[model samples]
Target: MYLTPSMAKLVHEFNKLPGIGPKTAQRLAFHILKISATEARVLASAIIEVKDRITNCPICYNITEDSPCSICKDTTRDHGLICVVEQPSDIIAMEKTRVYKGDYHVLQGAISPLDGIRPDNLRINELLMRIQQEKVKEIIIATDSDVEGEATALYLERLLRTMVARVSRIAHGIPIGSNIEYTDEVTLSKALESRRIL
Candidate 1:
């Protein structure tokens, strides 16, 4: 069965998304075609709304509608302690737990030489600036347990040794090769509780 030009285009666009294959994209396009026009409009509008409203928090670089974001602005949170993470999505995962009430700083991405992503490509400079500006007592390196995450953690540890009072790494409750995004709230909370000094 030959697909029309518009359907083929939609499939191609969906295929560009992470984890979406050509077959899945085609199936998704067909599903979209079967959905009501009003439903499609709602989906399209939601996508547009996110693009229009969501912007990076200037302080932590987390995705937010406001400048500094609620976490950064919340006085109830520990201002001296900051949790460092690779992506904004990891913040959502961490928040599911009862532990960890400190603020967060999103690195945006990890350092991967093979991927041509260096420390400069992340928010390391911004983090350093923040540390200098604030009385940051400690920084928890909450990058994933993968090789890239480990390398990034080591690099950050070395870089942040003298800059801050202390630096820590989240514990091994999260299995190697497993991402924090998929980790359960219990495991994530335990990991934070058992974090080791770096």
Candidate 2:
């Protein structure tokens, strides 16, 4: 299929994004072509605006328009507890729960030796600095359940034990509504391990 030069270029750009296959990129490019010029310009402008305005928070490494980010500046949140996560998106997921009212430290990426991501590649040093400077009493490792995330969490837990008063990993279990019979062995094991007395 010979797409117009402009459409081909747009598809190529879209394909550069993670998880966007060539077919999906072509579809997106065609969809963009169908949209009005003004609407397309608005979309383009929004992308440019995010690139121009967003910067990592100085304290937590979360993406924000401001230096410290709103969470770091908030006086009502718990300053003595810091939840560690692999990315800024993780912070968003945690915040959506509305239960945790603590500070965060975005590691920016998890430890994955196979992918060449190491402790130095992330914001681990910055997190350590924050722990030393701030009155952080508890450090919660909230990395994902994958191999890299688990490795990152374990590494952080060990490193933070002597530094912080308490270091704990977030409990991994079967999701709330999921059926026990359908749950995988690892998830079942984790759920059992994290079972509460209540």
C-alpha lDDT values of all predictions: 0.93, 0.93
How big is the RMSD of model 2?
A: 1.1
User: In model 2, what lDDT does residue 69 have?
Assistant: 97
Which stretch of 10 consecutive residues in model 2 shows the poorest summed lDDT?
153-162
Candidate 1: give the clashing pairs. none
Which one wins on TM-score? 2
| Candidate 2 stretches greater than 4 Å from native | none
- List, residue by residue over 1-198, the lDDT tens digit for candidate 1: 699999999999999999999999999999999999999999999999999999999999999998889999999999999999999999999999858899999999998999999999999999999999999999999999788899999999999999888999876688789999999998899789888789
* lDDT, residue 129, model 2: 94
| Stretches of candidate 1 exceeding 4 Å from the true structure | 174-198
For model 2 the local lDDT of residue 127 reads 93
